[model samples]
Target chain A: MRILVAMSGGVDSSVVAGLLAEQGHEVVGATLQLYDHGAAAAKRGACCAGQDIHDARDVADRLGIPHYVLDREQVFRREVIGDFADTYARGETPVPCIRCNQTVKFRDLVALARDLGCAALATGHYARRVEGPDGAELHRAADPARDQSYFLAATTRDQLAFARFPLGDMPDKAAVRAVALRLGLAVAEKPDSQDICFVPEGRYDSLVARLRPGAVAAGDVVHADGRVLGAHGGIARYTVGQGRGLGAASWDGQERLYVAGVDAARRRVVVAPRGSLETGTATVGEVNWLIDPPSEPLRCAVKLRAREAPRAATVAWDAAAGLARVALDAPGIVAPGQACVLYDGDRVIGGGFLRAPGSVDRVPAAA
Target chain B: MPVLGLDANATEPLRPEARDAVLRALDQPGNPSSVHAEGRAARRLLEEARAAVATAFGAKPQDIVFTAGGTEANALAVRGLAPGRRVLLGATEHPAVLRAAPATAETIPVLPDGTADLAALEALLGAGGPALVCLMAANNETGVLHPVAEAAALCRRHGALLHVDAVQAAGRVPLALAGADSIALSGHKMGGPKGAGALLLRPGIDLAPLIAGGGQERGRRGGTEPLPAIAGMAAAALAARPEAAIRLAALRDAIEVGVAAAAPEARFPGRAAPRLPNTTSILLPGVAAETQVIALDLAGVRVSAGAACSSGKVAASHVLAAMGLGAEAGAAIRVSLPWNAAEDAPERFVAAWSAMRDRLSRRAA
Candidate 1:
């Protein structure tokens, strides 16, 4: 079998490519030039090929496989980065990694693999594709610490059928690095990428400011009880349920406050007590179902954010509206634009992006 | 299956005669500037190679200024000559020349068929202070020949200096440089090694040295000349056969016919224009050039599209965009047949290409 491995110049993907080739499969490596790393790093006169691309090419050479760098800058900028900034401007937190996987990584690469006549498109993602009774099913990695099924919740069934994840069954990062060392790959000791890939110096606020200036403009931090607490540099710097950066307004009569909401239209960061930040129901739009859409409400474990544990919830699917109403059994902090992925044990059942709590009230109810 | 090379415009395989000359030159070990007996022998070889290149390109032996490559030759011509003059560049000029020009330099647009808009060039010259007009003899992507002679005549009437980049045109076509002040040539593009190129000047035209070092090449270009590559270039130039290009045209035409028959949507961009004999730009209406290039590479055929950057990714061509290709700008791939292409080259490329087209098109459907 011939497989196209999406090599990111990292240890995990390099091991994936090496393992497949060692098994006598024809492995071709591909790296996406997602953005101008030189410009992102603010370096002057730097060549477009950064250290990551160079490492990817070197690893491909060592494996005796042909490697190609595909230009995806324009599409990535339009789809992932643009959506990220716009979501921030609308006073919502965003999972840019999800957008990247949904569009640039899976959808585009799967089509490219087909065009190149490859049997499957493999990646370094810590997830699994199992043959279920219905068809191909997306599952969590054996190592729960490195499982990335939450970020890959938007992958379509057709794309999942043509995708492979060799790193899913690995024990952990240390084991993957050991495989890299055994294969003599140079990225064996390379540190894992942190934060957002495009953010420089771990300061995502600057990137958001450069993209959406209106989102980062100075605004007032107001209490939910109509009191002007203080002034904030930007609404984008605050997310729902965040406690830090509220200086001077973080405590009133020894009662700690957290970010309750961001009113973009009013340019106000609304802060209140921790109890006020919790929500019982989250309206999630743009729902993607791994299994068939259920006719009635389905009881499952729902995850509201990437790092959070799955909570008990009853998800009601409205097929006509293409939205899922996730009713959490316990009140939890729900942030808009964050993904609400539903899971059944280690299997991903469905997922969607969480809408604002009052969005349903803005629309007339069905008679 | 052996991979067939179809990207000659990017680079050509070294000719055997040129390879021999390079090896022979490498055996010597003296700088041309040294005063020893070995240095005298090196100087003699250098002059002889210069004479060979001068004779082949219709220039005087003293007028050739050796540089590192085509890009250096172009930069020397532009940066050295455009100090007091307003630089005017053709829309389809290479980035080597475009980026070398002053920020205020104006662009002369090209026609829809990929040829330089001579009327627009004349108008820009007529309205000018003394100008340095830069235009390529042949567009690299489409191989469409520009009207260099006519543009040179207009330059003379307007008292402007014309610099023609003949990197892709030198051996493939007869260079029309009657009134042109300077011309640029690359060694590797004409079946020589990679490290040598030259800027040929008219009788008394002198420019500042881009690299100021120990005076060499009459102080026009400084730095120790890469003797082996220069020798190879001169040998390749002297051994070039203009008649072989005619045969290449037939093979190239056969390829277009086969590809068009296999995929009816295939369109040739510069087919109606007077293009180089060995080059063809095929545009498949709905397919991306990147996918096409990669698919063909995997099928034992190597081709290129757009301009490959430092990361080895093909970008959208500014040349095609200037020719008003619009949406089809990213859909075209350049297939330039090399000088030593096999007789069955057309058949092999077409078979691999059509099979790829069928598979990809079916997936699209």
Candidate 2:
């Protein structure tokens, strides 16, 4: 099979490309120049693509395969980075990685692979694709710590049909690294990229401020009980349930405070006691179903964040509205814009952005 | 790699004349800068090569200033002459020229045919005082030839200087150096060895040196020259026949005509424009140039995308974009027949392209 592998110049993708090439598949490696690497990524100490592009080309050279670096700067800026800034300005945590994969990595790269006569498009993602009775199904990785299924929940059904995640079945990233070392890939010892791809320096505020100017305007930090706590430099700096950085009131030792909500329109960070931060219901919008949506409420486990354990939940999907209301077994700090991915055992059902606290038409939490 | 060399514009297979000259120069080792007898012997060979290179491009030996490669030559011309005059560059000019120009230099737009808009150049020159017009004799990607003589006339009328980047056109066509104030040539592009190029200046046109070190090339360029590469460049230039260019052009025509039926969606950019005889920029609508280049390479054919960047990534061609080739900018690939291109290369390319296109279309469907 002719496979198009998305090589990030990282060990995982390099190893995937090597494995496919070893199988005698005509593998072509492609890396996206997502931003102006030299002018932007390099000076900003961000995980820019300059060195990665070099590494990917080297890997392709070693594998004796043809490689390409596609410039997706415009689309990535408009879709991922621009949306990230907009979401942040709206007082939401945006998953730029998920958006990037959904658009540039899967959608655009899949189109490119198809145009190039590739049978399947391979990636280094840590998620499994199981051939179910119906069609290809997305599943969690065997290694729980490395499971990237949540980030990939929004992968469309047609995309899953064409996508191949080769590193999914591996026990851990160590195993993938070992395979890469055995294959003599130079990126075998490369450390896992810790920060967000674009937010290389971990300064998301600056990026947001630069992209969406005036988003960093000073706002009042108000307690949920209508008490004026203090003032914050920017609403973009705080996420839901974050206790610290609540200004001087957070250190007064009165009580542990956590951000309950953010009203972007009012430019206010609503703080409350840690106890008030829990929410049993997360109204998720923009759900992309991997399996058939259950007509009725389906009891399943759910993952609120990438690193957390799956919690018990009942997901009632609304087809017409393209939203899902997940009723968690216990109250969790379901942050707005954080993915609410439902899982049936190990397979991903679907997921979407957690709605703002009061935006779901006042659906009462199962207290 | 057993790859057929169709990416002549990138760099051609070393000509035997060039190879023999390089080997000969290697055997007689001496730095042309040294004052020893061996140095004098090296200087003689260097001067002979300089004469050969200058004469081939219709310039005096004294006018040629050797550089490391075409890039240095172009940089020397643009950066050297950009002090007093306002610079007006063609939109389709090579990055070597574009990057070297003053940041304030205005761009002269190109026509839809990828030809330099001479009217725009005239308008810019008329509007500015003592402007330097930078245009390429032949575009590296599309191979579209600009009206250099006409441009020179316009520059003269406006009291502006004209610098022609003849790197791609130097050996492929007869360059009329009398038309422009200066010309930049690359050795590797014209079947010469890498690491050698020359900037040809008209008599009495004293420009600043781009590199300042040991005074070489009459203080117009500095640093000790790479003699062997220079010798090879000149040898290749001398060996290149204008008739070979004509033959290659015919072969290019055959390739376009033969592959036309199979690739109905393929477009020839600058097809109606006066393009180089040996080059063709084919735009495959659905497939990317990188994909085509790779697929063809796998099938033992070697070609290149039009705007392959510093990292060898086939990015969208700004040249095509400037010419209004919106989405197709990234889809264009250049297949330039080398000076020694075989007769069957045309058929081979057509077959390879058709097969690749067929497989791609089927896969897409």
What are the RMSD figures for all models against the true structure? 2.0, 3.2
Q: Chain B TM-score, candidate 1? A: 0.99
Write candidate 2's Cα lDDT for B1-365 as tens digits.
Answer: 45678988999789999999999988767889889999999999999999998778778999899999989999999988889899999999999999899899999999999888888888888886899899999999989999889999999898899999999998888887597888999888888899999899988888989777888888988898888899999998998877677799899999999878888788999998998889999998967777788778767898887666676666778888999998889888898989889998888889888999898888778
Residue B75 lDDT (model 1): 94
Candidate 2, residue A133: lDDT = 94
Candidate 1 has a DockQ of 0.88
Q: Residue B239 of model 2: what lDDT? A: 85
Q: Model 2: which docking level applies?
A: acceptable
Write the residue-wise lDDT of candidate 2 on A1-367 in tens digits.
Answer: 8899999898889999999999999898898888877656547644445888999999999999988787788898999999899887888878888898889999888887876768899999999999999899999988888888998987888999999998899999889989988998889999988778777579778888888865688989988878887999888888898987876758436688888888899999998888889988888887778878789999999988776889999989777666788898999997787777889999998877788856652232211
Task: Give per-residue lDDT, candidate 1, residue B352.
Answer: 92
Each candidate's B-chain TM-score, in sequence, is 0.99, 0.98
